[model samples]
Target: MFSKIDLKSDRFVVVFINDILIYSLDEYEHAEHLRIMLQTLRDNKCEFWLREVGFLGHIVLTNGIQVDPSKIFAVVN
Candidate 1:
């Protein structure tokens, strides 16, 4: 399990890592929560492949979880 980033802004939360940008949006109160989540991931040193990121509205799924899906790659099996 990973700790979550907490964001206090309604705007989207974007983190620039390895030249790629990971973005996520949430309700105003959720802003701080997003920040905390990001921080937790950083603390744990989780390896994230930006190219495989996904998005769903305000949700961002990077590793199998429900995410934006924009940077996620489709697996051909």
Candidate 2:
């Protein structure tokens, strides 16, 4: 059901299972993208959540993405 909609490029969007993450270089672009993505989803009658994006063992930060400390402990413990 989700494979039909075209978002132009994969650089701005990431999809995993039921989660979708839309990102941009600045707040303005992000907002515009949110509007477009939300409208697209709405037009498709799809439900979505506006939550902080998570990448399992990876940490997401303002400066960059990092590996979760717990993941390293779990790996080497």
Per-prediction backbone clash count: 30, 0
Candidate 1: C-alpha RMSD to true structure equals 10.4
Using all chains and alpha carbons, the TM-scores for the candidates as numbered come to: 0.22, 0.66
For residues 3-53, write the lDDT of model 2, one tens digit per residue: 733444465877767656677888888878777777567546443343443
Local distance difference test, each candidate: 0.41, 0.64
Query: Model 2: how large is the Cα RMSD against the reference?
Result: 4.1
Model 2 segments more than 4 A misplaced: 4-11, 42-52
Q: Which ten residues in a row have the lowest lDDT in candidate 1?
A: 1-10
At residue 8, give the lDDT of candidate 2.
Answer: 41
